[model samples]
Target: MDEMPFCVHDVLNRPLFQRAIVLAGAQGIYREVRWVHILEIIHAAPYVSKHDLILTTGLWLKRSAKSGLEYMRQIIEHQTAGLCIEFGTTVDEIPDQIIDLCDSYDFPLILFRQPVRFEEITQDIHAHIINQHFGLLKKLEQFSQQQQQLILQSTDIPAILRLLQSYSEHQILYLSRIEANTYFPPLPEEMREAINTFCNQQMKHSDQIQEMELWKMDEHRYVLIQPVVCFGQVFSYVGMLLHQAHPTEYMKLLVDYTSKAVATVLLRTQFLEEKILSNQNELIQDILNRSIDSEEQAQMRMGLPSPNGEKYIFVGGIIEFEHNVIEAGPERMESRNQDVLVLIRSLLKRDRMHHVLMMKNNQIYLLCAKARIGKDSESSLYHKIQGLIDGLNKYINQAWPHFHFHIGFGKSRTMLLDAWMSFKEAFQVIELSQTVPAMKQNHYYASIGVYQLLHAVPYPILSDFVQDQLGDLIAYENKHHLHLIDTLAMYFKCMGSKGETAKRLFIHRQTLYNRLDKISDILGEDYFQPQRRHCLEMAMLGYPLIESYHADQ
Candidate 1:
């Protein structure tokens, strides 16, 4: 602290100024002395300034005791550091009235035991003050170097705070607005409450306040707050609390410097995090798009476990964010995304799962190693993939209950080269489920049944196939306003049971038989043969897609 050099008590502790004794104002002994000034006239108070330690021979005050009292008041009014009265010249001894005035004002009054040259006193005190300033500057330089080293070594905030606390010798509390928590050296319950309350009130006023300020929480404690600002916004605050009601100017300076260092660390950390996230997203996109030419290249880019001919299952999940929720604001979406990422990463790490997770086009994709734990079962991969999906969904729902989110998993692939197919399968399952009402949550490729195969077939091929098999009946039904196609489908569904087909169609047996006779005339008698019937049934299974395609045409 520069305090020792600029203090009246420390000045007296020096050998050259040791002859000085306090006549009154003992309570003000610790007043800081900024400069030493010689005062020979009674009207010198006008020229005095704060922290100026006055040296005098009491030449004017001896002429009138009443003026001595007035001079003390003037000294106190100007907030001078202290008054030193030389006892050997002009005045024999200090006046009782002057002493009382000094005590009342809490002003420091010193009695010089012997004759002391004003030039000598000023020279010595000013030299000490300069040395004190130089020492503080040196210390500040060292602190800057140390902080730079610490930042380069690690980006841990707690470690940084611990170092800063040692240098400051004061209790420190770091409140992160981004993390929504207080960190660093722990605080007492009462102290934490007081700081939290103060922060809340300040945020209510303006969250962008970046300046340092002091608050006297009580007679024994004072808090200094220095905000960590980035891009004209305050993201956190570093607060210092001391037992003294008023801390030294030097201590305040240290606090400001530490807060600035904290801000630098935060900005650097954020930049690195963003850079890493971007790289991860790019790698994930490359993998899912089949742009990654080789598994070796993937391992090099992500430092992930090498596939090395190992199998992996690609699980893609999409949150069809409600338009209203998205329209609400970007902040809400950003918060939710962060929560999801954190949860997924945590779960992945906890389970020691070899996985890659990233966000692409507002959807999250996960790729996990498909290594079997023991004897592989039909449902082992399903259970594994389902567990990850359920865990992520549960956490997300817990965090944001008002929002609706659905998750889907895909089939496992035996080769890394087929990862892109797995990703597409998972994505398609999600799209199909949401598009088709019959699809359920947690939908997967296997659960999609024949619809999966129908989707794989091109719309033109499926339409041509449908036309080749059922074109005549479809044309007849369209021309006559009769549902021969429906009747045929029901007949096929009921395995050609006349009574069952009629019952399912809500028609009489006579009506079904008549429709079947017309269908036979359009398709020929050979249509009901085993091979032709199989082809017709296959086309029937894909009829919906084929019909939709023809309608669009």
Candidate 2:
């Protein structure tokens, strides 16, 4: 005989309740267990039904002494296990009427202090309930193990269908995928109507998962579907219609394992069939690759047509995987390819002027659409690119982490291949920008265009120019601890006016003149010399470049 299953009573005996009782002492309520039973708390009469315990504060009795007695009478009529009234709130004394009612009903009543809060008690109760549930799961698992083994070993589909029919009273259909085609077997008229409605709804909403439910046909009526995929290809779907409510957890686990076994069997069958078909399609792969290459050549030939001497600009980028990031694993690569292709297609469809292509090597090539420019054309194009980048980042970030994009825009060209040539130049420039000391040190926009050009110029040549023209003055000012560079820059900015320079620096005019005279003596040249002023101004503007050089070294 099966053992009588454990229930909440087993939970009440656990150590968690003892801990709660200890904690409650800290709140000044010393609790003594009277009786624990299930009772209904959310009912009109507040009657005890199947709950574990009932707790109350005597304040209700204190407000209307007679009603308090009547309240106890109602509780007794409900066959409650026990009652607890905390002390020091409403009723300081237990009235004889309440005691008499409790005595007649044989209900256990206990009293405690005000320190215990109801919240702590609820925690202990839930902990006990969860413990009881886990215990029940263990017992069910032990009983279902043998039945699960039989289900996996069985091969008779008809027998399995009969078993499913007995388990549920609802209309059930088996769904399977074969060679990427979804199949649904014949169903009862009512079930077919429901499924058609569900399929139509699914087709209308791309954002929702495809699922449906049918009810009120019979007791335990429901449907289950299982999808089978092997080697990244879906082959068949198996479904069942039931006439009964769903099974218990143990039974559900058995069904799931059985479904997986069936999927494995079907996969083996498909593999044998594919082996026979492969010999007939020996040249298929070669043909597909050649076709793709031909299409690419055609598109390249038509690139950016010139309209009556109008020119077009081109931009291109290669997405590089970061160090140690393997984004092209077989599973993820397929999905990524699909996603990027869809994105490019959508962008082209939305803007007819734009032409975009995805290369075999995963490089994205784009042509900047040519149009007769009005006043706001450049600004509109810039804003459009900014919005596109923001949208692309949002979509791509969902699948890949740290998706870095390097983009280069080319000058307008009338020839088709000229656009491709511009893309190549921009690509080279981006690469060169990565090497410059200043660009590398800053890291942000290190691969940008103008900064790349500035860095490409020989640093020693620029440095020599500054030193040869202003060496003596620069050295003297450095030795004397004067901000000669800043003073000179500001002085010239003020148009050689002493007072304005002093005001800008928040120093007195005399102080400015004194620094200027020291500057003249150090350089052994006139402070008013135009050549000296010109050299100093150039040096100040080149400060950032100089800093970049030093950082690289």
Candidate 3:
């Protein structure tokens, strides 16, 4: 429970109010009281704020000829704490209708049969109200200090939430999208799932939301949802249920302080986890840099299984990021990395793949190991890894499109020490992905077919090779704005089937024939001969890679 509110019940127990008689609306004696307001004006509802205790001699009602019931009605409409009337001095008398109205609305009405000094009453009550607020502030300060000490001593989320529960005395909920969800006082499993599903839908529909608000969970429940922010990102939310009561101002303050404490705990825990990950990544980096020389040294450095009975084949892979599309600060990038890291781990676990994943600056690397199953072991793992990347692309594109990236895999190695060779092959695959859009679908280095042979050739030689066969045709097509090259390439792709080429190009056969004639005149009819056909086909394949590379620059 929040600090017990100073209510009308407390005020009635004061020495000065001891002689006051309880009229109707006695059941509302617990209404919260903030301060005392003495008003003798008509339309007093606009002058007095909510939770104020009104002290008056009924002067407005007597002078303005307003009904006693109407005056009390205005007090109730303003939501004042209660009404205390000095009965005899202002020619006043209590009306049954006024008492009935107060009773119906649960608005408190207190009567003083004798004349009383209004100034003394205001002074006595105002001091108590101010002192109560000061006491609450001091208590909140102490709670904050204790929370910090507990966080410093241990990065335990549940313990901190439990402490908040002790003060708020409400059901606590900590929901996280990147981490595990935690709740206090225990919740049903189905209820947890329902809440998670609802939250996911809300986030997908619109993630932009206020930091703290009263969210209605169902028809009967409302919760004060406070997003726990760490390093400028909200990865999780922590809230306290409001039961059936509306949250008070001080209660809102309590929730804010507690959320800050939770954020501190999350950041601290992430800091510690990051330290461990950094050390592990250092080992992976050393391997990539070829600093580790021996199999035993590599295994020990990464804490991998020793040279025992089960032989593990190691392969390297990379998820290379595109830098041109994003402009984010280091902190925002780190937060994005954390989110991607969690999703990647979940994928690895689902595939039951043993791996050591490393997150470097612009790329994520995974050194995976599987039991050797004859010569097909590597091939089997290659397909599985391909499927994993495909799944991730499909899932993350819909969920986190900004995480767009290219993927590449290397050949499997028998020894852990040879992991560096795998990484080198992965770099080769990444190079191909940048130049050849077709290579994006073929993640494995072996799947590049003829490109693997061309990879050995120098870049200048490859460019010269393509130009020597197709340079005149390229210039002719560019100058005339013709589709001769496309028609010819599709003809090659369709294996000289003019009908299929025309259909694929969405053109008539006559149009394709005309383009092909132009292509023949620029190059020569002998270009389709066995030797020249081979050269022309190779040039067609290399032309796209060169074109895409230049476009990227």
Q: Compared with the true structure, what per-residue lDDT tens digits does model 2 show for residues 1-553?
A: 1111222233335443332221111211212222343322323155455332566666556556577776666665664445655566545667777776666555656555453555555566656556656765674464345334545675444444444333433233444211122223346678576654554443334222232332233454444544444444333334544444433333344345445555566555555544543431222222223332442332334343444343343333333222223645665655665455445444444445454443344444444554546655544554455455555666567545556544444444443334454455545444443443333322122235464444455778768866775677667766877787678878888898888899999998888888888777766666557876666666555555666567778
Question: What would the per-residue lDDT of candidate 3 be over residues 209-285, giving only the tens digit for each residue?
Answer: 44787777787777777887776667677777775445766777878887888888877777776777777688778
RMSD of each: 12.6, 18.1, 5.8
Report every candidate's CA lDDT.
0.72, 0.49, 0.78
Model 1: lDDT of residue 458: 87
Show model 1 residue runs off by greater than 4 Å.
1-5, 16-19, 42-46, 60-74, 92-100, 178-209, 280-553
Q: Provide the lowest-lDDT 10-residue window in model 3.
A: 301-310
Residue-level lDDT tens digits of model 1 in 250-360: 777777777777778877876776677688778778876778777756655654454455434434444444424546477767666665665566566555565666765
TM-score of 1: 0.51
Evaluated against the true structure, the overall lDDT of model 2 is 0.49
Clashes of each: 0, 34, 0
Better of 2 and 3 by TM-score: 3
In model 2, what is the error at residue 27, expressed in angstroms?
36
